[model samples]
Target: MSGILSEDALDTLFRHARTHNAWQDKPVSDETLYKLYDLMKWGPTSANCSAARIVFVKSKEAKEKLKPALSAGNLEKTMAAPVTAIIGYDVEFYERLPELFPHAPEAKTWFNWSKEWAEQTAFRNGSLQGGYFILAARALGLDCGPMSGFDMKKVDEAFFAGTTVKVNFLCNLGYGNPDGLFGRSPRLPFADVCQIV
Candidate 1:
């Protein structure tokens, strides 16, 4: 059984964590990016259908390519970030079930038979993985600014053209600039948003 996390750990992962809009000049190394993925990949997904694909846009050229897709609100901060992660959903991810879900060799057939079901599963699991990505980055002492304010078609064309992968969302990763943070937003109380039933 897993032991409970310390209060400090919970604060780092949730309570005090903020969506940063500005970044310090520090860079996030390629090795750290890989490590971030290695940690987040272990998060759960339906039938273990790990369908999230990620692209770390750290180069000037790549950032420029992504610029046109960003909404006006996201452009400046995204460009300033040390790395912007393009979290995408792989529609054909089920094909890998033979390997990812080796215990059930027939798993791929379930998704292959229905394009609609496949698409839903991809988007849902991909979004879940995106959440895990944020937590993993935080655990590694990095901050995140996740956003959906972008032109999906443009992002798909720029990053995943002729491929089964499609952009789900974008997350800027870096050391956050505290001066850029706004007041924390309020959340719905547990009684209002959850139920014991």
Candidate 2:
């Protein structure tokens, strides 16, 4: 429960978890996936709405169903990875507001009355949770390849029909093949990117 990682260890987790393109034919066991979720689920969300939903695609059939939706560049790598997570947001997440925010009885009713507000909130928070999911996967020693090169409508129609959960993004997970990585990209310096008041 107390701090488990030293500063150096935490920094190493960040530096090493790059977007890996190729996998080693290794599998990410179900226990490891569950542990990753256990770590990620506790990350902060607005009003504890906890709306992010993850569908782990591991079966050959499921991956086949997803292949046509991906861009050509992503199809092979995605299919090769041990798992491709379909990250999504539950649009009607506010229905649980009464339980998530019991002290505020009107919270659930506030969003329930407007489908637009519900959708917007779901998109915002679900996106945030997706970010947390990436960091969590990295911390758990899994390589990630988060991608946007896919057909969202087709993905949803194939994997999420008849559900409130709408796909936000896709991530492939497994042991990274170091040979497949491109040179590390650059980032703006803090001095150039930020300003003090």
lDDT of each: 0.97, 0.89
Model 1 alpha-carbon drift over 4 Å, by segment:
none
lDDT against true structure, model 1: 0.97
For each candidate in turn, the TM-score is: 0.99, 0.93
Give the best candidate by TM-score: 1
RMSD of 1: 0.6
Model 1 residue pairs with clashes: none
Model 2 residue 7 CA deviation (Å) reads 3.8
1-197 per-residue lDDT for model 2 (tens digits) = 68688876777577555888999988999999899899988888878888898999999999999998999999989999999999999999998888987889888876778888888988898999898888888888889999999999999999889988899999999998999999999878999999999
Q: What is the lDDT of residue 5 in candidate 2?
A: 87
Q: Give one clash count per candidate, in the order shown.
A: 0, 0
Q: What count of clashes does model 1 give?
A: 0
- Weakest ten-residue segment in model 2 by summed lDDT: 8-17
